[model samples]
Target: MYLWIITGVVLIVSFIFNKDKTIQGLKKAWKQLYGIGSLLVLVLICVAIALNFINEDLITQTLSGGNRYIGFLSAVVIGSIAMMPGFIAFPLAGILRQNNVPFMVVSAFTTTLMMVGILTFPFEKKYLGFKVALIRNFICFTICIVVALVTGLIYREIF
Candidate 1:
């Protein structure tokens, strides 16, 4: 993916140079990319802070004894409803794993966290078109379920 992205950048730069708009195009791309990077960093920081305040042991105890299927369902439901930052999710997942939460459940939850932002629905609809947003969310949710099932089967087979 990184190789493809770099190749795409090189191609775009060459095209811009050929068109004699290299400097302007580069500037525009840089600004847009930098803004996105900044936003991602900010989100990460917020997530980290939230995770730091939560009780890791308590979360682990809560999730560790649950059935794998139940955990997966809970993750999907919570991910859809909860609007917590990704940083918190990561640490929470780590704690859950330590206490024996199924890998499939964690994977599904993480996927849903980024893919199905219930809290952002209105904003997404306004900015990206309702149909587009709905379709994307549906696809993401379906894929998360499929992935969880496959991962659960694989884990069962391996261990």
Candidate 2:
């Protein structure tokens, strides 16, 4: 890929100019990668477990044709809690959509999937204080529901 090529060139240039610094940088990067990689693995494992437990039938049965408010609330809560990467979440969302999941539900889930992170609350609270973090997440959560509902309505009216 282009990015791989670019990274290789940059790394070669770095090695040419300063081997020691480049080695130190690589070591630091490796440590960071190790930590992040472990976290990613854990997240993926949890996602897989959840996906196995929550099948298409379950989603269709629960999230479909129910009270819109209930569907929206369920989507928001599930989205806020799921901490998978967008790469994983997007495809999972597509599967939900294909299984006749409401676009509104998908929108809410995907939006909050990116915006809210219950798992990351501790980190947010530590840096931003609990009140600010809570307020921000609450606002984002409200926006996700509004956006999903509006989008669903528009889609229905237009098409």
Candidate 3:
């Protein structure tokens, strides 16, 4: 709320100072937003559908129960596949923690959710080329696991 207020005030000030530039900037911003809007909506819808099938109990059982490695692997796979915005992912992480899901699993999910983009691979590939996109995704996936393990260690969720 505060951020929005601040942004609105800043935008108003910019408009006052240079109406033409402000209008031009806003037009470009809108174009970019419009370009990505459909894809963003599609991604959010996919995440919503996925969430409908996943309950808090299932998350706790799969992520915090026996076989930590397997649980971590499951989180990596699911998170890598599901591409959601950070705004949604962070709150979801909180919910997972509230459900008693271990920090390691939550980290794995959130890290991979932010880093890996399996669902957006084609879009990335189009701009970055197939090889670069694939390599980036692979590195991000590895880093997310490392980050999750480090977080687990810090939180003493792992011995």
| Top-scoring candidate (TM-score) | 3
RMSD of each: 6.4, 4.3, 3.7
lDDT of 1 by residue, 1-159 (tens): 999899788868788667566666768989877756755666566556644643455445545665776677777876664456678779888877777788887777777877887656655575578999999888888988888778878888224
TM-score of 1: 0.58
lDDT of 1: 0.71
Off by over 4 Å in 1: 1-62, 157-159
Write the residue-wise lDDT of candidate 2 on 24-69 in tens digits.
9999999877756755666667667776765545655666654766
List the candidates' TM-scores in order: 0.58, 0.64, 0.70
In terms of lDDT, model 3 sits at 0.81
Question: Once model 3 is optimally superposed onto the true structure by TM-score, how far is the C-alpha of residue 95 displaced, in angstroms?
Answer: 8.3
Per residue, candidate 3 scores C-alpha lDDT tens digits across 23-123 of 99999999988877877777677667876766445555677666777888888887887766677778877877776777898889888978998877766
For all candidates in order, the CA lDDT equals 0.71, 0.78, 0.81
Worst 10 residues of 3 by lDDT: 53-62
Model 2 has an lDDT value of 0.78
